[model samples]
Target chain A: MAFGKDHELHQRRFGRNLWVGACLLGFVAIVFGLTVVKVTRDGPIEGFDHTVRPQMTEGAK
Target chain B: MTDTSILPPQSGEAGFGDYFALLKPRVMSLVVFTALVGLLVAPVPVHPMVAFASVLFIAIGAGASGALNMWWDADIDQIMKRTKGRPVPSGRVTPGEALQIGMWLSCFAVVMLLLSANPVAAGLLAFTIFFYAVVYTMWLKRWTPQNIVIGGAAGAFPPMIGWAVATGGVSVESVLMFALIFMWTPPHFWALALFMKSDYADAGVPMLTVTHGRRETRRQILIYTLILVPVALGTGLTSIGGPLYMAVALVLNLAFLKGAVDIWRRKEEEAEADGYAVEKKVFRLSLYYLFLHFGALLAQAVLRVYGIGGW
Candidate 1:
């Protein structure tokens, strides 16, 4: 019904693949976003530093 | 003669699905998981953004390696029933196109890793791609029976790359991660070759089973399993290895060794009658071995957040 019989057959056969492709594209976009963040940041982008000693990390900084 | 029309359209226009298959996403996933575990377990923590970028590039590099492998193995792939329908062999994508995609992605991944992490990590990622596509695929696979033994280094490099991303240097822990995978590959693969002997034979790939014969292949698997025990167990004493990973490695290795022993004791006639049950079981265990080990490492990383690990 979506694309008539001939096209629909191809569609069903490949339908799940479209979602996988979309997800991969989404993954690429997220990586690109993270890369931009890392490039622009003065320090590490997320800025949640882990270098502070364990005792110091326990409290709000 | 095979009917040209019934064959799955060798010259057909490539679709998005065909292109995705070039990445070998399942294999890329293992690369990502091991890389993630390596990153998380490092004493020097990575910024989330930096970590994400590093892993993403590593995955891209893995995909590039896969594409190049499919390109080179297209002939043998067509001969093997398991791989006959892959993008290059079934002909949804042309060999030339796969080569171009692989080359471009390899450069992009290495450069991106350099920008996001350090040159050490970038260098490792580049070496991994070179090892897999050039050393392993182009040369060793066809040339030797010890293909997986030597070529396994390509798969083993991801964690080292991940560790370098966090600390900008390799350490004992990272090396242990690398060794674990490197040691595991042969037995993992040979077990599959045990049951699917005909496939390797027809493809002329010179797998250990093809070159050394089954009895020798079985003995080699046991020998490698013995060597793997000390390597797998020793990782528990390192920075990333904690109580959980130690326990998990202990249990999995014992189970694996037991399985290898079971396979070693069986003959071809008995195996064939039971549908190669023992070899099939060992093959299934081998698939989970790396995942469970890496999963325990990740679990230890989480436990560290609650103030427990690495002791």
Candidate 2:
């Protein structure tokens, strides 16, 4: 199929193998990059501190 | 002349992909990425699901603007080689139908954003649609050589909208993001105009290259690029970026500035001697230049999660 052919043809040709490979590579890169930082770092990153407990109290002032 | 035997009429069938092409998926992807960066970098936290929905609606709104742009610019697009094969110009979609789709999607995306986010984000989304479809496409594009320079603001709004969605208001951070893209637009687009001067000339569009001259366009490209480098790096000095992002910005801006200088120093005759290949390379690099800058922002956001000082 040509580059700008219909969606189905695009899916059949580039979608299955090439698209999946590209996406998988992106995912792996992100995960690997994060893991590298996690291993070398001393503590949780500032912006991504998901472990910080949220205050449950309502505004009492 | 005698009447012939009855024959079957041809079907005017259009598919979903054709409709999708009208949305300008490449542009939408940039909108989505930049908007997501805005959301991620905001001081206030939003639920993950809500953030996802907000970005989705923003992407849809960008698509709506693209569709409307195609509908309005179909005449010029049909003549310009760069845009001649767009869905509307190629007869895959009718202008009326494209207009309907664009307007309907514009409303749908705005309402969805309003429901999921706040009114400020919704208002910005609406203004962006109106700016692109009416102000830029309808008024400025045909009138002036500086159309893309001023009109590029419409494309620069998504990150601000995303920041508004996360924080419920505007901030300097969002404005910096807006300014980065807004300043980058002229040099990035003018580089292409330098090489494709003939295309604009053929289509009778008054691009800077066609109206002023290639030398003037090259000078403008260098000036804007010089301005853009500082703005791009300034975003790194803000709360949304950190050391890593700053390093990337410095390197990228230096390279971009070098490219602009090379372009400025060359004459059109010198460039054209090699088929204007240098200008074309700069144009192609400009595309990646934006993507890499934004991609660095996304990387900074992820790094902030692991304590790399993004925030």
Candidate 3:
């Protein structure tokens, strides 16, 4: 039961897990950044939030 | 983290890099670069964040299709020298996992693209994935000698999709870019087939070389290169083109045509003696031929901002 060195398989698996975690974090950051830019842009805010927006409604213009 | 000594480690168990290898990163780099150029060269200016996200999604879609290809082509890949070491054929990644990853990423990329860009771009990206994965990899690859000719349309779509991301529709410029790639694909691939020897034949792939004789493949390469000259030069005459693009296209096309001619002229005896050196050189130049043309376009776009580009 004495632990000397980690097995090679475990190290590879660990590295894989770390990279997957990093990818997930990066994806989250991109989504967050996109949300900020999209909401703050010059035009009216349009999202799929279920409720109808006035600008999107027919005959509003 | 598990018990250290009991279970023997499984050989060929996949690592993260193996999964990434399933995506064919080299091909993805070409997709990213061409798509970026397509987006940047458009007349409409895109928001940096939106542009970045769109390109990323496009790349993901491309990677997904590549995974699908690796999954489906595993059998033939195991027979081909260059592809036998790929993730699926090498047994580092399972075919089932590759298919699952491909499908999931394809959906994710298309949905994210629709949200990030426009429906048109998303639709094109979806079609591209389908074309590459289902049409090219599944059907045409095994069934026809002209597989690469038609399958090339799958690769040629990215620039058009990139243009659609900015313009929300098609245009002559985008069509021209697509044509440039479509025409270039045959000659480029034929040159590789010439040098690759019998990989396609051994794999039962009906490449032009395997179906038609090598002389016919050589002749076809020259014909396609001849046709490609007009399309490549014609792009230089469009709005995306300028003096710089014309200059670069002229020089590059001449060199490419010369290489094609050299390939066509060399006899089989001399080629075998020299180890297809002329074909190899032509193949190398073809790589630079496409890149420099795209680079010149980007350069022209940049120069236009400085009042020195565009006629």
- CA lDDT, every prediction? 0.86, 0.82, 0.90
Poorest 10 consecutive residues by lDDT, candidate 2 chain B: B1-10
Residues B7-50, model 1: lDDT tens digits: 34456456676877899999999899999988888988788878
Q: Fraction of the real A/B interface contacts present in each candidate?
A: 0.20, 0.00, 0.70
Query: What's the candidate order when arranged by decreasing TM-score?
Result: 3, 1, 2
User: 1 or 3: which has the higher DockQ?
Assistant: 3
lDDT of 2 by residue, B1-311 (tens): 00111211212545566777899999998899889988887878776667877898899899999999888777778777778787777776777778998999999889978977889999999999999988998888878999988888998999999999989999888999999989989998888877664576665567898788889999999999988988888888888878878888888888889889999999878998998777888888788878787778878878777887664
Model 1 chain B, poorest ten-residue lDDT window?
B1-10
Worst 10 residues of 2 chain A by lDDT: A52-61
True-structure Cα RMSD, model 3: 6.0
Of the two candidates 1 and 3, the one with more favorable TM-score, higher being better, is 3
Docking class of 3: medium
* Interface root-mean-square deviation, each candidate: 4.3, 9.4, 1.1
Docking class of 2: incorrect
TM-scores for every candidate against the unseen true structure = 0.84, 0.79, 0.90
Which candidate's TM-score is highest? 3
